[model samples]
Target: MTVKDLRIELTSRVVMAQILPFGLLILILFGLAISPDLVVVGDARRPVIEEIAPGLFWLTVLLSALMALGRAFALEADDGNLDALRMAGLDPAGVFLGKALAVTVQLVAVETVLGFGAFVVFGAPVARPGLLAATVLLATVGITLAGTLYAALAAGLRVRDTLVPLLVLPVLAPVLLGATQASRDALFADPGVPGWSWAGLLAVFSLLYLGVGMLAFGPLLEES
Candidate 1:
């Protein structure tokens, strides 16, 4: 079942959905590189990289995730194959993991690509490679774990677009704030303790969401 889910995600639709964010991030980064610095800077009146880059990186990541959510369940629904999977002996946890796996791949790919793009465009360097990687990974999990479940809940709803954001944003705000701030601190080497704290929060969110989603997915899908 895991292998089957892997196959579906590796195919074109989900892969493209994953990669589209790279393109969008590139465009945004390019715009920022060339734009007229409308976003003001911190004290000392200097246009600090730390002040602006994190928000730009995070918003791009969020938008890209939003774009992919709509496409996440379509592959299963369009072919009438999700019903078949339910009928099979696949465990509920297996099903959630499969879906989460696909979304996680998509999330990580988008983040990696955009991270590199941010590096190139903003020249944000990692002061501590290990910490930076850990922060990136935790941020990805926080996004993907919650995202997978909401994607499931809003799967067939006509108002999914509206509802998913409503469901995810309030839930995601803390993650976003923590992730953006932590990534900045870890990469730039300031307030490292707070950064680790945010990373810990992100980790907790990921594990909690993963366990809850794994436990609830079968029942959620049964509604469909």
Candidate 2:
């Protein structure tokens, strides 16, 4: 498929599968932020928002990532749309890119909502907005590629519904650790040497998964 055409098709499905949950995750985070215990307990340390919020933020992001992965191909598989896409000459790489792009957009949306909520509920400083934004982008892109690839592997299988999370989470251990820690520093903690270092790791992850997904997706998506 041409890049433009593939992107359009990918965007349509991604919005359906990825965006809604991302939106909900932020709302959930917002609710959690108001929890007197969560915010108040961390209150004394004068902790940054990351220390205060990264736990919740990462939890929501993790769940939302799984949700996106779970739905990645099932919707298409159910309607026999998967077959149509391949038969229509959709490039496997294009398909992966399009889907990842959509998920990335959703991730960004979640970050936006979370950003607003963080300020409103926690009164977190918006200092280093650029760094914070970069952290969000890194987190979202990593989730998108990792989840998309795993989703491709599990598509149309009975085990897929449960297996996506099981498979993706273990593989994403490093990402979760690095992204969470890095984000915490940028958002809440002092952002020591480890903070900047973690940020670099997040970038490496984005590139790693982007490459892996692009190469592996074509094979994985072929009708078995």
Q: Tens digits of per-residue lDDT for model 1 on 45-149?
A: 225666667777777777677656666776677677777777885887887787777777777777777787677666666766676788778877778778878
TM-score of each: 0.85, 0.80
Output the worst ten-in-a-row residue range by lDDT, candidate 1. Answer: 38-47
Candidate 1: misplaced stretches above 4 Å? 13-47
Evaluate model 2: give its lDDT.
0.69
Worst 10 residues of 2 by lDDT: 41-50
Q: In model 2, which residue pairs have backbone atoms overlapping below 3 Å?
A: 48-188, 49-188, 50-188
lDDT of 1: 0.73
**Local accuracy of candidate 2 as per-residue lDDT tens digits, 88-185:** 88778888887777656656666676656555555555445556677777877888888889888888888888888888888777778887777666
Which whole-number lDDT from 0 to 100 does residue 23 have in model 1?
55
